[model samples]
Target: MKLHVFDTFAYSKTGKILHFDVLLSERNEVKAHQRAIEWLDSIGEQGATIKPRGCTFCHTVADAPQFADEVARNGYAIYKLEGCPA
Candidate 1:
């Protein structure tokens, strides 16, 4: 499966910038934005907001087995880039 990658960044409540990628099987901006927020919330960044400008379509790539498996279980998968909690 081909996955659409959305490069997303947002500021946490503590003013730390978090960089991550939202990968989806389909290219839907709305869904991508929602997924970004969901991931932020999951990582205890409930106060972080993913503005439309913050999340932009980056590129599409063939899904790896791990990513494909995760996307199948969840609606989307996130690839943490920077400033994300371990």
Candidate 2:
């Protein structure tokens, strides 16, 4: 059961797409990946500024690459965090 944490972050460039990091633990890997995808999809369905693949949550970024890379190396793909456009 691997646990994955999702955090969000903004890029240095202006108008750059938002970014997010998905953290993963060996025990919650499978569920975390599934949840990550689901969360993205949910965000997208709402017609969110950022699409599922593009938008990310704050938690995903606060932790950072180290938090998500672990999951990526295993199998889960990372989603770049895009903020809710105003």
Candidate 3:
């Protein structure tokens, strides 16, 4: 499967910046942004919003098998790159 990647960044309540990538099977910027926010919320970043310039189309790539299952279940998969809570 091919996945569209959206590089995203959001600031936590403590003002810590979080950087991650949202990967979706379809190429939809709106959905990508929504997923990014949803992920932040799930990680306890309630009410977090992506920076105006934070979410941008990065590239499309072939899916890694591990991510396929997650994409099938969640419609998107997150690749946390930095500033995320372990």
TM-score of each predicted structure versus truth: 0.93, 0.29, 0.93
Candidate 2's TM-score reads 0.29
lDDT of 3 by residue, 1-86 (tens): 99999999998777888999999999888899999988988988997768787988899998578788899999999998999888
| Runs with alpha carbons beyond 4 Å of true place in candidate 2 | 26-77, 81-86
Superior by lDDT: candidate 2 or candidate 3: 3
Error of 2 at 35 (Å): 19
Q: lDDT per residue, candidate 2, 21-62, as tens digits?
A: 555553343455465555455555222233343323233233
Candidate 3, residue 52: Cα displacement in angstroms equals 1.2
Off by over 4 Å in 1: none
Q: Candidate 3 — number of clashing residue pairs?
A: 0
RMSD of 3: 1.0
Candidate 3 segments exceeding 4 Å error: none
Candidate 1 residue pairs in backbone clash = none
